[model samples]
Target: MKFTRKAQAKWKGSGKEGTGHLSTASNVLKETPYSFHTRFEDKQGTNPEELIGAAYAGCFAMQLSFLLNEDGFTANSLNVNADVTFEDGSITQIVLDLEGDVPNIDCEKFQQIARKAKEVCPISKLLNTNIQLKISLNN
Candidate 1:
């Protein structure tokens, strides 16, 4: 199975004064706005790190769901939050906070599955930074 995703960016001006527009292959981003202030000053626009965090969170949650089904547990619901740490112009770390409700599963077992998923997730394996996971499971 092979697939490709794409996004493009265009910038005008320079540095913190410049503004950019981002668009994806599917137009989901449709000329989204971004700027130095958005990334560094927490302004009202999307940033690269925030986008990466969103992708990671979504991928990890889906991986967890696959693992839960493989273990014969019916996942009632799953939620994951990714915290991407950007420092000194570099990505320092990523933390995945997951909460799930699954039937016929113990906390210990759920943790084991979560840890395994974290290691196996494509995005997690692709990122080399310090990665951590916090999981809460409910029966």
Candidate 2:
């Protein structure tokens, strides 16, 4: 099976002074405001890095769940936090911190599955930078 998703961004004015709005096909982010202040400063708005982080976190959690279920295990909760590091005009690294509560699973098995998921998740494969995973499993 194959699928594609679409999102659009419109920017106006100069790089530092300009503002932009992002919209997705799903309408979840319709005309969402983003600007230099939002990306570089502490202003209240959305940015590319945060969006990437959110996507990675969501993707990894779902991938992990699927892998766990394949092994006859189910997760009670899987909390993932992705921190995307942008430096020197490039995305340097992404760190995924996962706190999972699964039943009838050992730490070693959980760690192995999580590592595999991190490697195979779509977003993880799309990124061409260093990726790190930190897992805290409660079984």
Candidate 3:
């Protein structure tokens, strides 16, 4: 029940003027471009915070789905969104927005499960930031 994934980053030049590319063993990203422009200047590419948000969203969604199934409800659709807040050169907060359509589930129970998921998700535990959750149930 243990696994490891690898991604590599290569950079040339200094911080402000430097350019870099990231590649992963899964090949989901292949020499993807990332730099100061991409991270701060609203340019075309990816950044570490953006990637972390993506990973958190995906993990939360999957974890929520598992919990719903365990609760005897089958989710028709689940959407999870993570907003990562950066302040004072540090990641300050992570906000999770979750919406789900599950059969035979009450809003109260769904929200309860979502709260549990937010508390137990691996990334939520890994990041030492304030985790805020907003859950919406669609039948």
Candidate 4:
């Protein structure tokens, strides 16, 4: 919303047999390789689903951190893992698992805030598929 980020991807040859490269403005992924084998065969390379998972996890964590700060709580650490489900040439669902170390926060409250963060995260809002959140709180 506030920042304009950019990423470029180029593919050559056929869909299943071809290869592609992806690059981001930050250069974190500079011409990274992706192909059918990498995406669907569990080969060693980067893929779109994994990249989306990373972005969603990071966005949700930051949003949750901000929400905690607003409630006068500070998080020592927040670990989030996003699982993207791709089936039948479509992404059906995404699951975000969060484990947080925040001092003096109840599980119920943390769960509530985490759910809210999932609703409001930029990536979550941008996505059109089903999204679910699972939370584990440590005080």
Which one wins on lDDT? Answer: 2
Per-residue lDDT tens digits of candidate 1, residues 1-139?
9999999999999987999999999999999999999999999989999998998998888888898889898789888888899999899999889999998899999999999999999998888899999999877
Error of 3 at 114 (Å): 0.6
Predictions: Cα RMSD each: 1.0, 0.6, 0.8, 0.9
What's model 4's lDDT at 94? 96
**lDDT rank order:** 2, 4, 1, 3
Best by TM-score: 2
Q: Give stretches of model 4 more than 4 Å off.
A: none
Task: Give per-residue CA lDDT, model 3, range 1-139, as digits (tens).
Answer: 9999899999999988999999999999999999999998989999999999999999888888888888898899998888889888999988888889998999999999999888888888888888899889888
- Model 4: residue 51 alpha-carbon error in angstroms: 0.6
Off by more than 4 A, model 3: none
**Residues 1-139 of candidate 2: C-alpha lDDT, one tens digit per residue:** 9998999999999999999999999999999999999999969899999999999999999999999999999999999999899999999999999999998998999999999999899999999999999999977
TM-score of 3: 0.96
57 in model 3: Cα distance from truth in Å?
0.4
Clashing pairs in 3: none
Tens digits of per-residue lDDT, candidate 4, 58-129, equal 999999999999999999999999999999999999999999999999999999999899988989899999
The lDDT per prediction is 0.91, 0.96, 0.90, 0.95
User: Which has the higher lDDT value, candidate number 1 or candidate number 2?
Assistant: 2
Please give the range of 10 consecutive residues that has the lowest summed lDDT in model 3: 116-125
